[model samples]
Target: MANDEAAIKSYLAKYKHRDFTTREVMSLIQVYRSLTYRLEVFVFNNGTRKNLLNLEGTIPVTYKGAVYNIPVCIWLMDTHPQNVPLCFVKPTADMTIRVSKYVDSNGKVYLPYLHEWNPNGSNLMKLVQSMIAAFGELPPVYSKPRNEMPMPYPPTFPTTFPHPQYPSQPGPTFMPHVRPTAEMPTYPNFGLPYPHPGTANGSQFPTPANPLPYPTFNYGSSPEVAGGTITEEHIKVSLLSAVEDKLRRRLNEQSQQSQAELETLRRTAQELQEGKMRLEDILARLQKERSDLDKNITILQEKEKELQSAVERLGEQEGVDVDEAVVTTAPLYTQLMNSFAEEATLEDAIYYMGEALRKEVIDLDTFLKQVRTLARRQFTLRALMQKCRQKAQLAC
Candidate 1:
């Protein structure tokens, strides 16, 4: 025991200096700083700044004819060489493809080289290289979706050209281009009478005292003024016709929908009447079944009374002598014992049969029929037993 203790202490002391000594951690840190400087790899844990040496870096790997820069990470446990650092290939958010089997959901990489690692033989450099090589089998891609083109502005009422007689001017007084009169226009009650044909508005009544609100007679700058252009008038008419057609179509659709709903309601009313009749029939059937059940209940009560009287008679005749009529039926009751298990008695069979009947394994009719048959046989057997010679040989 003393020798074993000495050996263990020496082994611990040997490892006490630590394989990853101050120099090694510092050297790893230097390597990481240089790599981060060159490759733009960052180090972090849950958004917390951390020592770059421990958990992050990048490795260059080659596949086919191209080379890739794979972001790599290392997790160092306090027990280090006793527990090797876990390495991972960390893909960024842009890597949209399905994860390959070589990597886990957490982005940790797996390779056979890791299993074969020896504390004396392998270092962080060699392990990372192995991961890079394993990753060459399937590579990650940084992809971005192409942007779609934007839509153009919506259409507006066409601008009309000014009449040649009236020269154009800066900011001429006019409302924004009004829709063509082809549409059915809603004019508010101007409170003044409409003008007559030769007059301003179409009303024969005298002009209003307000002079029809300033600029009310304002017109478009279009060369097709009052009635000089025939084509414009026809185009305006066509637009009015189109608007009227749309209004007619909507009204027709509403009427058709109303008709369809009325038809559905009519069918539903008929179905409900038929369903009411069917329910009435079902109710009548249930009433008939209830009456039949009441009759059956009265019959069962009568049988119960007869069973009580027979039980009283059986008690009185327990040891009485019987005659020849019962002797002829004795064999039937003896046959019942054969229906039981080899090691069982007639009492066990009867108990199990009663339990089965109670559990409804046999229906009420079948149970009642069996009981009537057994009762007659049992009574005959009892009578024959009473008549048996007390001197007869007993059977096993």
Candidate 2:
């Protein structure tokens, strides 16, 4: 018995490393006799108490060096095969076993363990039957292979080594289960089936239920939510005031900017006006100078024509005297006697005599002085006209 207990303890230690819970370990021993031959089980914390309650009347026994605690009633079944030894013991809350059979390649009937254990060519059926005989029934809970079944629950790990009694925050100690309130009053359910006792006309004033106070929302002066203790009209007035203030400030700024621009434009326009007037004055002065120059040119041309005509007349008079001097070289007194004798004889002889006498007596010095004075007048007039033209060009 000591050796069997040691072996069971050793196997249980191995199972502890595998992270199988006590319930899962017991289930395996119940379902598979192969595991029961060398099964080990242990309990810690609440698990030990739960196991004791499940196998209340069972006795602990030993097989092949391993100890098992199982119920005795399963051993009395006549249908169980004889060659297999009752080996396994299981402790659990519920006792009901499920089994399936399969034939091995050697044509032997075998019992499968859970959904995972391979019964083919392994004496699993005989082992499972022995476990059933010892345990009375398999544990109700079982584990299946990962590929073939869904997990019963999500995996978890120990959150604390030494668990704390109190949670981090205070939660509700007792929450009363509350029934929902009845709906609002309706017409048909308002005691309409009962006859009114007071009034003969069947009209009676119903007692009024107390009216609930209307909720008051105070949104303060924040512009976000529109509802408040303040009326909507007051809010609208405040909003309009704010908008008007903003608009007034913007308009003032715009007006100031516009006034500044207008002043600048006025100054610019004044400067342009002054410039235009100056240009007009200059244009008028140039035009007047041009007119004066044109008039002076016309007068100078007329004076030059007159001077040329006078010079031509003087040249003709001078040529008459020079021709007379070459034809009649005699004294003035002898030319007078030739004239009087020619008058008695011929008219042509008298005319030639008078012309010759007049030419021989004319003064050359006086004629030259008159020509020099006319040429000087022409030069002075031309110079005055040229000066006027240059002044006009400079103004332009």
Candidate 3:
């Protein structure tokens, strides 16, 4: 029902701003119902990191006229939504098998849904649903018998109970030199009546004409593990080969993960470099601004010095006019006025008046009164000049 979608788009968008939590990702896969997930942080050989997720679940699939719960797994990449999650269909019983559709003996699924995964519309829920639908259509063929472990030899013992008819072996004896093989171990039905042990032999035993690879030592009346005897020297070479193959596949997967981590590190380094350049530019601007402020302050200080020098010169030129000094002596005042008419600077007058003032020839109160009277006289002169100018203009 979840399949046959027109487009793939982002679902659970509320979590887009941040990496999805394990719980959130599991829920999207329908964890409680038929899905499960685990989080893993991987550090690669190149000193890069990745937050990976392993997801597995069962889907209701119809396979070879039987409805079965087919197991599946998915590998979520670092940039999950922005990239496609690697999907796999697990073999039913672990025996190597492959199907024409999405199901394969190696648990590799080839499906359009996964191939066309779009970040805008694809989500865990939709992806799983699509997988379930594809798997339902002729999944990898496997038999229930394929699931049963081969019991080449199952150990058995005689019962010793209150019933005297049951016989017990004196001790635990075995054909230790006999080795088990791929052949199925024979087991006699306990319900069947057995012939008396005294005469049953000779027919069941082998002669010296045909030699077996193992020594002949009977554990019980019948040894079913092998045609002959079992030995400790034998090894399960097939099982070991299977294990080695699995290790190689795991190493391959690790290589892919390492490559992905390297890519992420490359992007991170580029961003850091860009940010550092931007900060350097900002720092340069700040330095320029600081230098500009220093120059402005230096110019203001130079202007202040020039203004002070001009004020000192003006004060020297305006030194102690006769009217501004106390009018202590008429001759001194006449001399001061004569000096002013001659355009004499105030510096010389201040020198001469200092001696007069110190000698008490001029009083402090009279000095201040003379300065005020001079200010009033300047104001009256300016007013008369302005009135004459107005009269001249009226005549014109």
Candidate 4:
């Protein structure tokens, strides 16, 4: 049970609506013991293949007054519950699909229940119930007798009719998808009496007064022929034919499954190729950026070496006065530098005399006289510096 639950979880992991889908599926599988779930690739009409969850098994349908199990496969899309599942009838070798309003020639089922499926209301259990009710009304397939001419179905006597209920529950005894004939009667409602339509008045049940006359075949009785009975040889040939038909059907199913898997592999390969191309593109861009960064680092390293060399040379000349280190280009420039120095010295002396006066170290009158004298000499030096600069063709 744990393994089954785990397997179901793994299969439904890819579903878009996993929570509700899992709940519905668990409920369905618990009720229908014959039904099994698998994750397989389902191909669309447009040639798109997707790995979807498939629940395949027989749903018990009450036909006439007897219960028959109808083989069906339900495919849930990735968007299941939100979207209606793809349903189909699977007829075996001994059965042929009966084309009707509910089922098509290809064994695809169609009904108002599926047509008007509501995500909020429609569920797998209810869907199966609807199928049971619908198929009970009009059976989708009829069985064929092996190696014999087709005969009309024997009229079933009305007895305890089986209701459409859970398949796992043992209230109704169900038969396989094998009916003897093509012409089958329809039930007005589930668990109702078998009504013969051909009767003068629609007879609901067979009675001694209105008994249904049906022919019975005795296979045990051998027919006498002029040349010996061919029953043994006929039986052998019939078994061979049945085996061949069963093998052919199995082979066809295997081939289709292989084809779908091949398509899925091809799609996966295509996606992987696309991903590789994108990754290659990103790698190339990263390499180019790395190359650019390397070149920039080399350039910055060269600039750092040049700056370090300049700093080292400056450190060696730390003892030299920066102003005196300037060598005048001509005699007039030399005189201009000297006069500018003297004028700056006089301005400093006058600033100190004003400070002394503020501190009362010198009288205001003494400070004024000293500042006036220094100012007169500073003014003369500044005029001489301007003249020397003009003579040297330098800005004043």
Candidate with best lDDT: 4
Q: 338 in model 1: Cα distance from truth in Å?
A: 99
lDDT (CA) per prediction: 0.45, 0.35, 0.47, 0.66
Q: Tens digit of lDDT per residue, candidate 3, span 1-396? A: 133011112222233423453334645644324455544443433344554565655555543333445555565655567656656554322222333435432345556776677666777777776876776564543322333553332355222101100011121111211225544222212232222112231112223343321122222343333433333322333244346545544674576578779989999999999999999999999999999999999999999999999999988885677556656345544444444443333344545556777799998786556546655655554455455445445321
Clashes of each: 9, 2, 14, 0
lDDT of 3: 0.47
lDDT of 1 by residue, 1-396 (tens): 345334333433333334453334445544433222111122222232222223454454555534444555565433445445555544433232213444432344545656565666666666765776776766532322223122221244111211111011111121222335532221111122222122432223333343321111111232332333335654554455446544544665577679879999999999999999999999999999999999999999999999999999989874756433344445544443332222244345556678989898998788777767666665665455444433233342
Residues 132-188, model 4: lDDT tens digits: 899987787765444544333235532211111111211222222333554322211
- CA deviation > 4 Å runs, candidate 4: 148-396
Highest TM-score, which number? 4
CA-RMSD of model 3: 21.3
Q: Candidate 2 residues 140-220, lDDT tens each?
A: 112222233221211442211111111111211111122254311111111122112122322232212431111112224
Model 4 TM-score (2 dp): 0.40
